[model samples]
Target: HRATFTFDLTGMASKTTNSRGMLPDMRSNLYAAVLAGLAYPGINGHPLTEAYGVRQRFIAIVTDLELPNDPLTVLSTCDECDRVCLRACPTRALAGEMKQLTIENTSIPFPLFDTFACDWAKRYSLNAQEGPQYWGVDESYPVPENRTAEEVVKAVTRTDWGVQKLHLNVAEECLRVCPARGTR
Candidate 1:
């Protein structure tokens, strides 16, 4: 089981994401060979489906609150900062600061943790633009243009966030930024 997970990470790190439009090289080539189960299909997007083996799906993701960034509070950036993946959402879905606590009714809505919503929305937006050229995960949704942001917001209430005293979704955004494709 661990080996299977490791393989997924290895493949994801090499080929899945390259928005910088770098020339493809076999030496640095890493992409799904149409074998890693298309995570997106035609519309919407995908959230986290598993964690270390647990079936805890997330719109955002919560693996990080369990293990937060050491300097997450500073809002600092590095020399080679490519926050495009972090800033990909037009709705500001993935923007969040790292912390261990927050407020919520049933499930806390952590931007970092909740990649499913933003990821789904990102893919959905891309689908609307490209018409299914890159359906990474196979899901469906009514056309987003037909609805208002508030309506879409209504669709993702706390229940969809999850059920718990608090939620943990740190990696969802960074993770969804072609995260399976490890950058480093």
Candidate 2:
């Protein structure tokens, strides 16, 4: 038997509303915070993003059995890259360099992620002249073009089908090319 714990760290200190309209579900700040706090193996060592990509979700398991924890990753795998992730970002989401902020007296460093652009790419594919591709032509759906991120978010949120379609798609190119977790 085991117990589990979940945290809504979106309001922790430095987190803000993300482009996807998701709070804690959008980025991995809370996971990183937890890893840093517990001195556990960080995302950098994970096979998926090599610590360069944001964690998707986190859950803590409490068991009665004693077990050893994995050693903490002291170095970032991204430090060895030639900025490939930044260049591959479709929305330039993770392109910004590190920026430090003092939140609740604690200095925290993070990237200036552009949620607007990130959400756009995730919800709809950009077709050079046709604009937002919400559905394929075979579905008799017309794609919207030149719409702002806010407009896309509003439209996508209006229907269950829209929400499902957007959520089901994985459009982040940067997340797809990680040497550790990606198909590269």
For lDDT, the strongest prediction is 2
Model 2 RMSD, rounded to 1 decimal: 8.3
Q: Please name the candidate that would achieve the greatest TM-score relative to the true structure.
A: 2
Q: What tens digits encode model 1's per-residue C-alpha lDDT throughout 1-184? A: 1122222322322212224332221111111311122121101122221121111221212132343222112111211346454565434444544332231222222223243344334333322222222323222344344455565554444112223343221222333343333122
The candidate 1 region of ten consecutive residues with least summed lDDT is 34-43
TM per model? 0.25, 0.48
Q: Write the per-residue lDDT of candidate 2 for residues 1-41, one digit (tens) a residue.
A: 66555444343322222235533333433444434343222
Q: Cα RMSD (Å) per model?
A: 17.0, 8.3
lDDT of each: 0.28, 0.42
Which regions in candidate 2 have their CA more than 4 angstroms from the true location? Answer: 1-4, 11-26, 29-56, 60-73, 100-109, 123-150, 153-167, 182-184
Compute the lDDT of residue 137 as modeled in candidate 2.
16
True-vs-predicted CA distance for residue 118, candidate 2, Å: 1.0
CA displacement after TM-score superposition, residue 9 of candidate 2 (Å): 2.4
